[model samples]
Target: MTETTRTEASKLMTEVEGISGAVLPEPAPAEAVTPLEQASPQEAEGIRQRMAELDMTDTTSIVQFGARAQSDLQSISQEMLSGVKNKDVGPAGDSLRQIVTTIRGFSVSELDVRRNRSWWEKLLGRAAPFANFVARFEEVQGQIDKVTDTLLSHEHKLLKDIKSLDLLYDKTLNFYNELGLYIAAGEEKLREIDATQIPAMEQAVADAPEADKVLHAQALRDLRAARDDLERRVHDLKLTRQVTMQSLPSIRLVQENDKSLVTKINSTLVNTVPLWETQLAQAVTIQRSREAAGAVREANDLTNELLKANAKNLREANAEIRTEMERGVFDIEAVKSANADLIATIEDSLRIADEGKRKRADAEKDLVELEGKLRHTLAAANSSKQAGGAV
Candidate 1:
């Protein structure tokens, strides 16, 4: 039985003991788990919630509220700018100036992944057997790299588009708000001219001596023209406010769409990209594993063949030795001399064979090294050709 099965059985026994009013010993503390393993589910849930909020799904009610507020602001700016100079209006004008600066300086934050080592890079290493497999891995890896580059480029473009939208919305809101304050300030100046300056100019025109009368009349005319300009400004401000207010709903709609897109992109980065990497790694591992198995079979076959060849060589050597012994049996003295010579020859043959084995091993090593280099060069050339073709 598995450890888990046994643990469950023991737990069941403990539970039964507890239920039967028998005292059960307390269990030891569990092993500590890594933070990521413990909190991954919680983190995913948090991402989902945050992404949903950013998506602003079914947020029509809030959008309608914003639309209503924009409408109310339009009416308020129009009504408030009729004719009034107040101390409070001064602060509003200053605030409008600050808002203008703020909107002009606005910037958006961008998200990016840090470039790190890939899993395949650590696996391929400098092994002769794996060289071919590494080449294949690199080929697939090149495609993966292209995909990564494309995805990042797309993400950058998407962020740029969102930034543009944000800039437009901010500019629109600030322009209308500042325009309203400017209209209010203009109306206040117009009130001062009408209520105070105009009457004073008229009185001066009536009571001035003959020589000064012309000058007073000129002053009154200038005041009247200034008042007319202020009245026109009030009309223009009203029209601008109405037009801008109409655009508010549309801008908000676009913002909602952009926000949804950004949220999805973020969600994909968190969930989809990692899954892709995991599956891709698994695929590469399986490929390498299969290649390793094939290599093992090839090596076994080669070893068997080498053993059979070695056996044949041993049989030939033994037959030659038996022939030499049979010839030495013809004369006693000749046989002694022949045996001595044969011993020397056998020793010499053993030394030659040992030298030949060492030389063969060296040649094999060199050949293997050359083959590895050739394979890598060909792989690189093929990759380059493929890239050129793509271009």
Candidate 2:
């Protein structure tokens, strides 16, 4: 009887495995797969052989994350060797190297995926519900694995976005800063024209009113157009500052939510899966008890063993599900504060640049005035000397 039961169980297990084999997703094709180790000469030879037998584009691989013992230098060296072994090209090699590089910096994959949840969502539990599944058993570990891949991919994109946005902001700020200085310099020169130069020019203009009107009108028009340009640039800077400010809440919320989700997923996964070793042990013990029973079995009692095993599983599953459902919310204050700081920086940077421009424009107006006065003084001196000689 015992031999019969064991054989039955083995057969059942085999059948289950067969069912699983059908549903398993095929490993992704390795277009740009690089690993985090230098394959030894022997391993390299093995890869070479493997490559020869197969399509290079069809290789599939698993990238391990959360191993902290390896240094960046070590990871890079490993990737270099792996690249040679696989003979990766173009996107495949680049993609594989990037995954290895990013995983090296973080604690785990949850820490890496930032796109789905904002920083605030993590703190406040707004999106906390989505991560519960990620916390479940190793049986569902593949779901968690998928999420991690998504996270790593997201981290790369966010990095590129941050760098690009920062570059634009920096360039725009620099342009405005330089333009402001020119405006200020022009304004200061305009201011410095001596009081008497105005009257002297008027007297000179009396001798040729039409010429003076044409020249002065054209010069005034040029100055006015320049003033309009400076005002437009300043106005554009202000609008950009406002747009960037409005984005702060969303950008910061994303970062906060991502961190929150990683923590929750880690807690759920650890709580639900490791307990399985205990569950399986209990299941085995219950089966043994049923096996040892003698002639005392009745029809109702015969079904009792199966019922007991199912009950234990139901209880454990229910308990874990309950705990996860009741998990507490996170605090969003940190995320809010960060948003405020970024907004403040945007405002402050714009103000500093604008202030410098205003001062420079004032200085230019003064300088222009001084230039006109100096020209007038030299003209008056020359005219008087000629008049004295005539007398």
Candidate 3:
């Protein structure tokens, strides 16, 4: 492990020890306690024994462990995304809209009894309004039933998603814990190599005879190589642990979304639907009361109009009768006009008689004068005849 990683790990161990009240082993010292080159054969033998005790040369299993954790994280991510995608609440919203539209389409006007129905229709209880109203109610109920079924189906799916998320959360935590254990073990192995094995092997290489030095040096080289491989494995474990840390919150967020959607679905099923149905029932009752009240108001208005019209006609008739009862049979103005017309006709007849008498007197005088003239002419003719005979 890197120095920073080791420091963090040490801090974590301290915190864990404090919480649990358990004593852990102290870390190895930075430098070796004794020089291996100047040591006796028994001391060198002890060094070799310690090296054997801390051997961790084979790292294939450790590497595979980290690779498995990484693979599991990828799988968890894919599953989490799929669950969230499948739990969509859009269909629930669509159902709510349908319910609202169905409710709005219901009309109280349909329940009003017709004013112009024939007498027989009313007597036989054959008014068409109530029938239409009942049909409207049935239609609304059918629509509500369909929307309710849709909402129920959506709620079921959301519930399933919530249960699945619970399992995913637990799996993510397990991976997190396993990575931590693997990293901690790798760190311990690395510490042992640095603190004890590498130092002892170096001393052994320096103190060996000229003929055996090459073998000791090769042994030291092999030990160092193992330490490098162990560090690489610990680094991989730390990387996998980071992935698990990020996944923990991501899973919880998706789970929370699912839970919120479920709560909304429950509210729609338990509260809103029941309240809307109750309100629709109340609307029908209120509409009937309104129709009854309207009929009474219309009757009162017609009675008032008739009373006013009769009173006006009676006032006019009484005025005409009173005027006739107080009047004379023959009005004085008519008698006076007739007498004046009769006198004017008599005066015109007297004037015509006077004009006729004067014309007759003038005609008599002219006839007497003409008779005298004829007698004188007869005497003169007799004389003329006598004179002629004497001659």
Q: Which candidate wins on TM-score?
A: 3
Q: Sort by lDDT, best first: what order? A: 3, 1, 2
Q: Count the backbone clashes (under 3 Å) in each candidate.
A: 0, 51, 0
Alpha-carbon deviation at 135 in model 3, angstroms: 14
Give the better candidate number (2 or 3) by lDDT: 3
Quote the lDDT for 161 in model 1.
Answer: 48
lDDT of 2 by residue, 201-302 (tens): 455555557857777655445444443443443354344444434444444443344333333323223342234335534544543454344324654576
Task: Sort the candidates on TM-score, descending order.
Answer: 3, 1, 2
What does candidate 1's lDDT look like per residue over 1-391, in tens digits?
1234334334433333333342222222212211222435754443233223211123342122123324545454444334222313234234334423432332211001112335664476533434544554455445444443443334344444444544555556655554454444445455666898889889999999999999889878866865675567556765766676566666656445544544443334344445655655775576567667777988999999999999999999999998898875377988889999999999999999999999999999999999999999999999999999998
Q: What is the lDDT of candidate 2?
A: 0.43
Residue by residue across 35-94, what tens digits does model 3's lDDT show?
344445765554444333334555554345345545665686687677667646677777
Reference-based TM-score of each model: 0.34, 0.26, 0.51
Ten contiguous residues with the weakest lDDT in model 2: 60-69
Best by lDDT: 3
Instruction: Output the better candidate (1/2) by TM-score.
Output: 1
